[model samples]
Target chain A: MKKIFKNQIALALAGILAGTSAVAGTLVINGDTSDPAPKAAFQAVIDGFEAENPDVDVVYNLFDHEGYKAAIRNFLSADAPDIAFWYAGNRMAPFVEAGLFAPIDDVWADQGLYSLMASSAPGMTMDGKKWGIPYTYYNWGVYYRQDIFEDLGISVPTNWDEFIAAGETLKANGITPITIGTKYLWTAGGVFDYLNLRTNGYDFHMALTSGDIAWTDDRVRATMANYQQLIDGGFFLENHAALSWQEALAPMANGEAAMYVMGNFAVAPLKELGLDDSSLGLFQFPAITPGVPMAEEAPTDTIHLTAGAKNVADAKRFLAYAARPDVQTAWNKALGQLPTNAGAGVTDDKFLNQAFSMLNNDAPGGVAQFYDRDTKAEMASIGMEAFQEFMVKPERLEKILERLEKARQKLY
Target chain B: MYSYWKNNQLKIAPWIFLAPGIFMFSLYVIFPIFQSINLSFYQWDGLGAKTYIGAENYIELLDDEYFIVSLKNNVIWLVLYLLAVPAGLFAALFLNQTVRGIRIYKSIFFFPFVISQVVVGLVFSWFYDPSNGLLNIILEFFGFDTIAILAEEDYVTYGIIAAGLWPQTAYCMILYLTGLNSVDPEQIEAGRIDNARGWRMLWYVILPQLKPATFIAVVVTIIGALRSFDLIDIMTGGGPWGSSRVLAYYMYEKAFSEYGFRMGYGAAIAVVLLLIMMVYIATILYRLYQDEKGS
Candidate 1:
């Protein structure tokens, strides 16, 4: 029996050694930052980091973007990985409030990320402390059909009147002026965010989304009025409500529609549908309240270090690595977005160039993360629905705004 | 231990056999259900501390427009979903005949049941797509403008129910088909002598024997209609502004979706839905008890 116990001890030691050798220093990452582009870009950085830091290994688990939202709350509070991928701004705020995320002040300071990601810093910060690293962000604008516009002799619109005129011109032609699908309902939000940002500017938009102001505010009604013009002009696709964002691209790709108010990420899918750079064009969502100073919708994607992270030191290293200008340059150049890192080099992709310039063009206010990112998910869900309903029936704007205001009262 | 087991094997073996299953059921099913009920009175965001807010969640639901909408949709689902049992009976009756290659027809008819509901939801979503879908093409061919089934608030729930019914009807048909095989030929022959044919024969002679199958069918269909989530989730996501939400989908949307995790409120919604299901289950079980007593 003593000999058997001795054998068990020997086997246990061997198992311990095996386990340690395999992954004692493995830094686990949990994310739902999804694909066609972002996942690969993230994986590349992970691979690069592991290769450079040969002492530590890495484990990556990617969940479906929507599934992760439900699961993250459980995981973050329990078996959290070293790092978790998520959105910045109000989306990160709730988690920050709950203290599920580690306050990574050291991460920002050690890497000098404060200066590097100055624009996105506020989005990830709550009560004067940083909770996550904002690695990358993309600008939202009107991606239009250049060839179709050339055919119609329409120049890119820069302000409300020109934008309306372009829409009228596109409508007068056989082509649909704008294509959108609000099936998942965030697509309408992009249009709403741009219009609100352009009309009321960032301060009011932020105030309104945060429930500091009511949806019944007249300035918001004015933004709705701008949206109504597009709806009444017969500008949008007839059955957009039935389609996903990808399905909405069918009309634009075939030149039946001329424009879409979407983000830079949509470029990859648009390219896949057989439209190249020469066929496409980029323009800022035209100014409405002409001097509102063109606040763009630029949602930053962030990575958080969990307070429950087993490998805090290694996760900090990864966060610092991700925040580095050289890493941001490589990651964003591959994904084709403007990096948050100030010193990061950018790609020569024309849309990316125009997007960078558009966001940086010394407009009075900088940028607002789009509706879903700017507000709580509950508010955003109701708001997106109201936006959809507004698109279909702008006459019900009063009722819709009243309903939204009621929800804001309840939720916030 | 070996000698003790050998001496009292019969006494210990049955419990030993049942232990794992009982352990798992209590852990996963029974425990979570009780926990959900307990959670209903407290405000807990799946991640953080739980704060007791006794009955606030239920009070909130009373005024919740989406909750009311979902409750109404559940009623519509239950009523419309009943049509599947009759439809399934008809399919089984129609295919009950002995024809050459009838096995292929059976497989084809049973195809929807074999496919996952997720796949069915996708197929139906594509089918209902206004511009690129076959349903709209057929509508256009008939010189009617297309109806965007999943997008229209009034029609969205109905569209999802139709997709759900496809698999549900197939499931019911298979159940009836098995029941039909167990149906006594002696009863059918006796009915023939009594001039009972067609509907009369099915009603009097066959269906009575198919009671066990009917019971299982109704139970499953009731459960299926209540949990008609995946189709609604995939096809519409309770949209055109939450018009398509059912109780299950609404609970999930509140608890899990990016809509925000109002766990207590979600649990309240779930408790109400569970109570509704429990009422039906109680009736069913009472009837089963009566039948067993009669036997």
Candidate 2:
């Protein structure tokens, strides 16, 4: 009887301890930190934070990459995490408009980190306030197989005529000049972004993606005409539509195809397939209108505070800590991408160096986030589908544009 | 109170027994249906305030070209999926013979149904892959140009339906196999004595015995056709320009995909699909009622 009474007393004491820890001030974070590198990068920052502030406990809710996209919409309405991982630009637009993400202007002011993230600020901005801080971003351009180009005696093309001629030469040698996989539909959008940026320039491309410019506009038609050149010339792989982006990489590796237009993130996987920097090459998509300054596609990933965030102070502190130059440099190094902070040091990697130059002030035209990132998600969807259809049948440009215009009218 | 309960037990007992089930059904199923109907009239982006705009979404859907294409594809799926019933019956008959290792044959025939739809979709996707896909490789061996079945917009929907039919037919075969086991042997013997054989014997004698199985197979096949989202999602994602989208997939794209959250619009699309499924459901129920009345 005495032992039973003692056990009951012990249970009550344990319950009290558990209750106290629950109220010990925790910053809940929902992140796609399941990937090893990202998890490590996040872990380092969290460790640093805890080392500094021992009073506060941190809770990290890690999810896999694709699952996080769907999970965010559902969780944001419930008891949302203090800090959430999300993309910048149009992907974050709807959430910002619905006020699911809290405005973190005060955090920026307190940390003075906004100046450090100035280049990436435009993507995270809505109206006047910054909704979040970006940590990592990567560039999108032409990823071509150099060995195939050498075999075909082709130099990197500069302008429209040279580009088409090079494609012809590659075709003569029995290689598809450009290989793409549009089964998932976003790869086609990357091609369209480059085409629009080169042909009509950045502002017009932005207008087109944002639904300000009609799909049937003369400029859009002109851009399609340029795109149609490659399509009609049979430059892309014949069975491109059947493959996903990863599956499409097989032909490039086997020398069946010469070139591909993809983001820098594709480099690691290509290297994993035993191809080096000499065998694989990165180049900007050639100019269509000779003097049109090249605006590059660099999509960014961001961290934000949810509106339902209970531990607001800790959330802001975490965002500020994440935006620190040393932290970002380490994170991006771990992540194998370019850090968003201007002062952050980048690792000595060739592709990332070129990617940095492509988006930095060295490039003539400023950064426009990729087609899908720059537009409303619905608008991007319509545009991507149209792009896929256009790639398949460029002759149906008029019809495709008309359909896209109608979707824009109804949706936006 | 106990004496009063005994006095009206006949009337009270049914309510007592049904109360929990009725309450649950109303909460989970019936309430959601009515809520969806209400949602169909509003414009909500799933996270924001809902604005009621009566029939606006439906009116927009009237002129939506994608809706029309999806409707057409759904019709294609519905028609093609019905072939499963006959195919299942044939497989059941083929495997009915008394032979060594017949159960193994039955299991092999039933294997596709045991696998999930997502895995089947993936397997079929590989089979239809243009460059090195099984189908194209065989065509190449025959000195013909390879066909990219999943890539062509005109053929994409049919390709997906063919994949869907594999598992649907397997499901029907299992049903028919069960029905065949329960068939009255005395009746079959009598039919044989009356000179009924081959097609006549099977149709007049065997098919009549499989009425219950046929009814279930037809109903399930129809439901499977309408519920064709997961395969399309795993395979094409309504792509090559949304050419292979069915109503369910289209509704999902509008409601939840990275495309955008147009919840009210999605609800409207769901309402249209519900109305279509309701017609078949109503016909089946009416037939069952008539059968009961005749009996």
Candidate 3:
């Protein structure tokens, strides 16, 4: 018995050494970050990975926002990267169904990643498998110019009536009540998602996208009516249809616009424009109607390994290394984003800290935002068009809903 | 034996010389056109297996409101884009003087065509900006309210076309400048002896010699107008309610943009765009064929 035990111990030690040496291959990573801060975060993580595994060589290919999406689609169909950053939800569904993305269920189990990631974010896992792990998440809300609000003697409204009153107050003070750029259309969807969630709650919002509820339902129509009210009340920037999200920021920064309902990503640009912490503030999109269940906007960013990866083991190791608390801390700090890992350190930026708190508290019940990742691409395109139409011509509400229903039916 | 080499060998050698270019044109251009037409009948999301949908994509397109909007905007772009040709001729005439700085003025006039369309879109976007844009600032100085040209539905298409015209007019100016250089000096002397001068000299004498340049200009302008995408994409992305979507932009939105990878639907839209373009292209080709026969 003693002789057998010694032989087993020797085999186990050899296996550990072999495993360590095996992780020494080159890893190819594709990421999207035109922003300098995010690029710095990704670079730090790559450096740390190379340092820990001295024998391993990492090749990182970075692309801008739209280019990244196109490159990933083309790469998956041909020579896929060992690992990539991709949106969760239906955006990843096409690649997943094509058998291009490797399942990371075992990694999740081994690393106890489920406990670290927000429980609600497991929605990213599909078909009884976890395919990717999230690194950072951001909350969507009304990012207002606090100085402008204070100058106008207005406070953040908590409910529907107060929200309208606030808009009225801003308009009366010669400021555009809110600023938004719908040239890409998705920015408008962010506002619509919050309105729908605050009006009909998370479950109903999911049902609406899944086609469980009719688009012409009373609750959906009510949300549309609320949006129309905002548009008609001069709550949005003039000529919003012509501007991009970046262009819209100029008006807000110049104090011509009082508020901007946007995502955490907008913070970087605001800060770049010299808006101090005291000048900027955030508040959850107010509930318009009573008795509606409310949830905060917590959009997530995930890293996935391709099923077609030539270096599967290396990719898995990279993903696991990325999820480590130390790596997450370094990445999130440089990126100015909140880490998905529970033990990750916090940033001193007040807006980022507030975003983290909002997401931590409200993510458990929140639905993913509309467009890009939540609804089917076909559905989202039509939905964004409909939303833009509704904003421009409030009288077209019925026709828009009916058209969306037709699109939804075709999708299923 | 020498006659055989001269006749048969030379004939075959010309074909051999032409083979590579013909093959490439057929493969890259002709084959893809046919393939896009075929792909239009099947529903594919690029990755998943395609479904044979017959005329379903076309039927769906008919009901699509955005498609209707895009079609209307395309017509508007086509009509408005033609104005660039005459505008370019006028500019070229104005700058054709033999003054000390004429060459510099000619180079300055040709500058817009050299820059990328993306840069043109960005520069124009800044110029039209409502808060601090050049246009708005000028309007403010003149005691008029700032106009958001890109945002208003009625003006957005015109705004984009105006940007397009800037580069297009430059292209036409270069064509005319080259044509003006090649005009027969003897013919101009004859017209001058006949008392033709200034506008009459241009109309009766110089304009007749400039037909080839005008033909090339119209052909290019028509193709450019039909294929307008970059300006719309960079300027508004077919927005304010998709009021500015030309067929090309709409086709792109359907194919690759957040619109589902409805490859079939995108192909269908492309087919429609192609058919509309074919009308103008066929006319140009037919005109060229006649010209060849005449020669």
Candidate 4:
């Protein structure tokens, strides 16, 4: 009777061990899936990862883009996932500084991701320690209706004067020159980043974000002046301040608006609205002044591991797989973005191909985006508000600049 | 011995019954308010250690142009939102008749309150759309140029307040409807005998009896106006360059939104907002206290 009881206890112990091992092999990811194609693409990668590691199970929790930011904060503060998608730059600095994120340096070195990622992944590092890996990036630029440009006999402009001329030409042809929604404020940032990059160049933008340059600096004033010019030229959608980015797309897709100065992500929405690849085209933002170093659109996104994560090994393995060339190609292709992986094959989609080529050949001296990710959040809030104020009442420029300077002083 | 034991048990029973509620109220409400006040005197990001910086945040607030704008806007919201009280009363009176399908009509009038603020914001945003929106379409039909209500700084705040009023008016209507149900029928008959009717009858008899509902309505509307975050967050995000920002939204932007975590500064903003709210809350509580004493 004693032998039989001992044997029964041993069998129960084996069952419990098996269950623990099975659970340990699974990885959970929290990400933003605001767009359908990107969500579907991410799911495909998850399936591929599971297929490659048959012992591993991948669980994904997806939220809307804007909703994900709030959800991520809660998740990080409480029960964090093993792996998560987050923005890089100063945005990640707080989390990294708090040791809420695991350093990815070991995995980064082992995979030699730097070789494939070019210089893009280095931006994910803080205090000389890498914390995240980038899968894809998109450039911010002018997306125009090619058909309208053709109808108006306007060529894509490479200079500021020509760009304004193009806007006038489109206007003459009964097309509103641009469609942008500033209700969220960051949409305005995309346009402003390009304007600043083209006018003041990259070093000044970096200096501006870093507090070395005041908001009222001549370089900053020039950037706002260029924006004022665009506004006065009747560029941008009617009632843009009332519209969201999706709402702004309607006019562009319907050919009522001729241009949209936005990121490559805008292609997905344009396609979703039933506009074909041929309907849209991309261009570098015109050089604001002759001989200024012209930068193309911003490139940023990161896949990070939480410091509090339990499944650190599994998370690293998942990130390594994500950085693989085929995974990068498949992911970017599905999302209509440029794969940071060097060997990732370019898509046949003309707009995407153009974006990839631009990212490869002519990307500006530096690779970071502006506002939210680049500057401290405290500064961004004030700076974005200042930008919005400048857009509405150009007369308030001096006050807005002074106020931003005050916010900068306090924040820094 | 038996009388002493029974008296002690009765005294302790009331305390026991009150303990759980009082504990919860202090834990969730009272404690957080004190914590926020303490935090207001420090400088800390959401993460990292906090450092004491007495009165610097407050002094900065004095010079904060955006804060000044937000304060002015909040005052406007408070003043404008009070219009819901009388408007709701009138709506309740119109729908209180014992006509056929009156129940359906009442429910229809409360529909705006049933929907979430996000949906309300979306609906109102579409209504104010310059090109394809219903408002502009109607204006164009009458040969008027489309007006972008949300884009112009002069009109943006009014546009947001109009959206806020839709649900606020509905809330007021429901409160008045309940008040009307409990009105003394004998008193109404007495007023009718004296040939009192319309505005005169309402002012003299019915309105005075509905004071409790009006008081509750005012309290709630003031709180709602002060806490108006969702509509502005969704519709305009206090844009056309911060023209529509209220204190709550501005506080959130300063503390949480993409800006750096100025948790200490945010707490400072919260403290100021709380002080402003305390004035209204104290007045309401004082009146309630007087009524209890008189009774």
Best by TM-score: 2
Q: Which stretches of model 4 miss by more than 4 angstroms? A: A1-28, A55-64, A77-80, B1-4
Highest-DockQ candidate: 1
| DockQ (Cα-based) for each candidate | 0.55, 0.47, 0.38, 0.41
CAPRI category for model 2 = acceptable
Evaluate model 2: give its lDDT: 0.85
* Candidate that beats the other on DockQ, 1 or 3, i.e. the better one: 1
By lDDT, the best candidate is: 2
Instruction: Identify the runs in model 2 with alpha carbons over 4 angstroms from their true place.
Output: A1-24, B1-4
Quote the positional error of residue A408 for candidate 2 in Å. Answer: 2.2
lDDT of 2 by residue, B47-94 (tens): 889999999999999888899999999999999999999999999999
What is the TM-score of chain A, computed separately for every candidate? 0.92, 0.92, 0.91, 0.89
Clashing pairs in 2: none
Model 1 TM-score on a 0 to 1 scale: 0.92
Which runs in model 1 stand beyond 4 Å of their true positions?
Answer: A1-25, A33-36, B1-23
**Candidate 4 accuracy as lDDT:** 0.80
Tell me the interface RMSD of every candidate, in Å. 9.8, 10.5, 12.2, 11.5
* Model 4 interface DockQ: 0.41
RMSD of each: 7.1, 7.0, 8.7, 8.0
User: In candidate 1, what are the lDDT values of residues B1-295, reduced to their tens digit?
Assistant: 9999899999999999999999999999889889999999999877678999998999898988889999999999999998889899889988998999998999999999999888999999989989879999999999999999988888988999999999999999999999899888888998999999988998888989988888888988998999888788778878888889999989977886666588998999999999999989899999989999999
- The 10-residue segment of model 1 chain A with minimum total lDDT is A1-10
TM-score, cand. 2 vs. native:
0.95
The sequence of per-residue lDDT tens digits that candidate 4 reaches over residues B115-222 is 999889889988998877899999999999999888887888888888999899999999999999999999999999999999999999999999999999999999
Q: For candidate 4, write residues A1-412 as lDDT tens digits.
A: 0000012223323322222211588787878765778789999999999998998888777655654654565566566778878877777887888777888888878878778776677568788888898887777778988877886789989999999899988888778999987777777777878888888887788788878888878888888899999887777766677677878899999889988888877887798887886778888778877877666655577789987677788889999998888889888888777787788887788877777777677765566565667888767766776776677667777888888887778667
